[model samples]
Target: MVQQRSVTYVNNTTPLSITTKELDLENCVNDNQVAIKIHSAALNPVDSVISHAANKWLVGSSLKTVGMDYAGVLVKRGKNVDPKFQIGDKVNGFISHAFGDQGSYSDYLIIDPSKQSAIGHMNNFDYLDDDVKARFSDFDINASYPLVFGTAYDGLFSNGQLLNSRSRILVNGASTAVSQCLIQIAKKHLNVETVVGICNSKSFEYNKKAGFDHLIAYDESNCLEKVQSIIKDKFNGQKFDLIFDSVGTSEFFPIIDTILKPRAEGSLYTTVAGSNKLKYTGGLKEYVSVLPLWNYAASWNPRRHYNYTYTMVWPKPAIMELASLMVSKKQFIPPLDSVYPFEEFQTAMDKLNTNQAKGKIILEINKDY
Candidate 1:
């Protein structure tokens, strides 16, 4: 039997254990599935959220693997696997934890082509532009790109409908990995002229260089007042065309009407973080709280003509492909706050819990790979 190391979550009280188990090739790698030797895995907040509170909702069993984003090499291809992908191909993407079967923090992963979200091939360094190539040069860092980028892409282009070059955008939690991607997309792809980012003073320089035209430091004593002031002063009193909230807090809801653009067609306010309240609740309470909060946000100020929506990255291959193309062309740069060896998984999780990581945190799974 082939055995591999995996981080398994049993319960909140018990420490996450690294267990050795036989690889269930037959069950995990089904028709149209591609088996991969995971090289590195990236950490996301949802990993800890689900592990601590929502575990049973996603994984019926008490013991389940934890992780979402991964970059790896294809080792086996099911008979019906797509021709475009072959054994030995290096790929990066995220898996859905909602199903609860497997996760990216493992020696092996099996992805069903028909069901998986955003898996794509990485181009060789020779083909990549020199400036952006160094980032992807490390498989550990490359592993961090897909999930946050996909979430940002879907939030901005799909849910927010930020289609016009004239659109003025504001990204809350501007220092987050997803926000960094959103800032880049707004500037490079959408070609928007005015891009505002909200973060602490420490990240002001980072976000500014990432193409944010204006910065609002939320740590200031009068943060909301400052946000309003920026809109009035820099934007000529114009409301933002779209507000992408990656922080998921309700802090902005009360003042959204003041800063958001009012359009008869409805200005869009999309959030990757659904509701701040839901994050603290668990089990039936969490499930029950989600809808009402969504409703409250959606109808909060209808008279202002702005619509509120929430989004999660649902793994679209096309989005991953588009991101790959942009990265190859030096348009999208992957952001990384830190990388830890697989043995230091707990340390990596600790950094993610701080909510202070400048970018994504990744675990180098197979250092040799």
Candidate 2:
């Protein structure tokens, strides 16, 4: 048994312990998977939850691994794989749910090329090799879309029910990784007349600079009431067309209901820590709908079948292509708060636990490709 150093839970209650572990490469579905020389990995709350609550909801089968989003270089490709990706190509993408095959924290990480959502598309062909350049660019085109774009991209267009020229939107947690992109895309792509951001008063300056029409700090006395007071007439004399919530705390919901017109469509997208909870009232439970944003991203068209309305959230190829263009154009900046050296991974996790960081935390892997 070959051992690889990895961070794993000693038990559900304990903090992750770093230890030498067997490389269960054989557990992967196929042999053609390529190993990524991980240069960096982003720390998400999901990782911590899985470490502690491994049994409650996140069942660890053969599929338990640390890290989800990674930026790295292709070190080696397995057999039967196309020769498009040679060694040393810069890449970034998400690791799938199958943990044994998708772990990205190890020195060498493996991924199926066919399954990657975002990868760097490099053009390193000689001028003479036009056909080769085109072919390589086409085949190895790891579309360089950032992970931060995922929640915003999916939430806005899919769940938020946005079209190119829809009504203005108010994003509650505008400084979040997801909310930043939401503002960018709404400002750039959509003809939004207004983009109000409700967040900490300290973040008011930043959100104002980022193009928010109004920046209200929720902690301020009667902040929600203030919003209502200011926008009451515009909202309908009593309503708004849409309200996007990245903060799902119970407190935010009444404000959401207040802002929305009685029959108007509104969506609330939450990227905050922890799972979503549905609230119900007496005898009205049947009509209430509580949804996860991912569900809309996967299945654009909600369908009613066999006693339930099911919508599958998916990464559409077209939306990803749009994200690629947005990246190359630099229309939006992804929120990368801080990068931690591999040895200081625990420290990075600590910072994220504070929830005070403005953006995403990244862990840089030590090895050079």
Candidate 3:
């Protein structure tokens, strides 16, 4: 057993508490434990969201760790871990297993074998390659991209019922990580008939390069009307087949309702509204599904959409498959705003909390990694 330094939230709100403790390297049963020599980790808005509101959900528990994504080399493994992964293999994963202690805000962390995303095949140490080692060095950034993509991909293809060469696709908050993934996947991979991105006018050009064939600025008094006019000019008065709204504010819904094609076979995917609130309106068939990243089993919002919500649990098998595919196609790229050494963890958290970083923030734990 080795002692691992970790970050924890002692109180329900504000200010953080970082500390260290002993973590067992063994004693893993049924493959419920994994020891990671954390090389790097990323911060998501959910951290702040949970920290501020988790007080209500508390059962008088004092321990709370806030982190969802981590990437590193496997230092130790519990028996029954996917048999294909071994010590020293590079991996990246999202932690959605039962919530508290399993979070990734630590020097070393454990992920139940069921929640890991395997990036490479394991081999006897002697047979590993320079490229694989080099690849592992960037796991932090590499792993973050998948979480964004998995959310967008699963939401679109599965929940939204989007298919290849379908009608126009509208993506609100197009410049976001999830939207970026949607743009690329919808345009370059799926080849939708039209890909439109809606955002502030200032970011229109940026959204264009990210994959939106058409960019709409929703800042005007008649922004919805403007969007409708643009679609008419472009698609000969056609309606959108799918709409993905990453920003869930109330304003977005009216815009979606106004521009969404009436009675068209399509859906509106929103990350802001949790799957529990998945709803429909105006005789428009909108499929709403939540982003389930914990269990592999697909559950539903139990709403009208009846969306088969499957958890994108970073299971080793799915992770390896997606990673290998991305590597083969050269798509495992992380959009990094900056990287901070492990010692600057507080600084990193501050930047993230302020919403100052435009892209993912990476924290390097080990100097050599």
Candidate closer to the true structure by lDDT (higher is better), 2 or 3: 3
Best by lDDT: 1
**C-alpha TM-scores of all predictions:** 0.89, 0.72, 0.78
Candidate 3 residue pairs in backbone clash: 116-314, 298-310, 299-309
Best by TM-score: 1
In TM-score terms, candidate 1 sits at 0.89
From the highest TM-score down, the ranking of the candidates is 1, 3, 2
- Cα lDDT tens digits for candidate 2, 1-369: 345655555334445545565665445325567766666677755455445445433454443557666666776667755577676676666554522434556555776666664444332223324553343232122221244566566656654464445465667677776677778888876767777788898998878777787888877888778678657655445444456666544354445556654333444333332124322111122112334444334334444111111222243344456655665665655555666667787898788766667767777664443
TM-score of 2: 0.72
* Candidate 3's TM-score: 0.78
- Lowest lDDT block of 10, candidate 1: 276-285
Tens digit per residue, CA lDDT, model 3, 192-276: 8788877878887777667678887866567666668877787887767676666543344445555665433545433433333
lDDT, each prediction: 0.77, 0.56, 0.59
Clash pairs, model 2 backbone: 119-142, 235-239, 297-314, 298-312, 298-313, 298-314, 299-312
Error of 1 at 199 (Å): 0.7
Error of 3 at 185 (Å): 1.4
